[model samples]
Target: MNESSDLQRFQELIEASAERELTEVETAFIGRMGFRSEQCRQWLEADAEVVAAAVEQDPLRTVPAATTLDWARVDAGLRRAGALPDSRAQSRNAWPLLPAAAALLLCIGVINAILRDGLSTTPQAPPEVVAEVLDLPEGDGSLILHEGDDEGVLMIILSNG
Candidate 1:
C-alpha cells in the first residue's frame, strides 16, 4: 500500500477508536503506524492522555448535608436592623384622633357651605318701583311701606293720633 493509504487508514482507526472499541486487526494497525511514524506516535500519546483523564475523573460530586434554620436569630437580626417593630413598645395613639379631626373638618365645610348659600342669594331688585301712590290726610299722619322676605309681598303701616 502507498504511504498516503497507510496514513488514511491510521486516521480512520483513530476516529473510530473515539466512537467505539477497535478490533484486534485495527489496534495492531494503529500500533504498527505509531512505531513507524513520529506523527502517529504523537496522536497515540494524545488519545492515551484523554482516556486516562476520563477514567480518573469522578462522575458525580458528593452533596452537602441539609441543615436546620434558627428563626429566633433571624427575628433578632431584623429587630436590630429596625425592620421590625419592638413588641415591648406601644404603638402611636395618633391613629385614634384621625377620625375626630376628619369630623371637625367636615363640620367646618358644612357650615361654610351653609353660610355661602345664605349669602349667595342676589338681593331682590328693589321691588321694581312699578308705581307709587300718596294719600295725605287733612291733619297729622304717617305711612311706612316696605317689601317682606316673600316675593311680591308688601308691608304697610299707618298711624294717626
Candidate 2:
C-alpha cells in the first residue's frame, strides 16, 4: 500500500488493539514493523486507561456549585454595627492635610532643582601649559639629512629667533 494508507491502517490497528486483540493482519504488520509485541500491547492498554480516566474525570463535571451572596443584607449589618466609616466625614477631615503635604513636596522639589542648577553652574579652572625646551649644542653649523637619492645632503639651518 501507499505510505499514507499504510499509516491510516496502522492507526486503525493500534486503536483496535487498545479495544481488544489485534487481527491476524495487524499481528503480522506489527511483527514486520519490529515492534516488541508484549510491550506494545501493554502501552496500548495503558493509553486506553488514561483516555478513559480523563473522560470520566472531566474538570467541568467535577466543579462545585458556586455559593450565592446577599450583599445588601451584609451592608445593612455592617452599618448597624457601626463598623463602616461615614464617607463624607472621612473625606472632609482628610482635605485640610492635602495642601500642607503638597507644599512640603513642592519645597523639596524646588530645593532639588536649585541644588542641581548650582552644581552645573559652578566655575571650573582653565588648564595651564608648561613647555620643556632642550639646549642645542654650541655651533654655527646647519644640520644635514641624506635621503636616498643620487643628490647630495639636504641642509637645515638653525636660527636663535
- Candidate achieving the largest lDDT: 1
Clashes of each: 0, 0
Candidate 2 per-residue lDDT, tens place, 1-161, comes to 76556555666776688889887887798655435344445544666877888888898767775444566567657867788766556755674365435544544554455345432344533212111122334321222212222233222222222
Off by over 4 Å in 2: 34-161
Would you list the C-alpha lDDT of every candidate in the order shown? 0.58, 0.50
What's the distance in Å from true for residue 82, model 1?
68
Candidate 1 error regions (>4 Å):
42-161
**lDDT of candidate 1 over 23-128, digit per residue (tens):** 9999999989989977667755876877777766755344344444556677768888888876434223342255435544544554455445532276543232
- Report the alpha-carbon TM-score of model 1 versus the true structure: 0.26
Residue 132 C-alpha lDDT in model 1: 22
Query: RMSD (Cα, Å) of candidate 1?
Result: 28.5
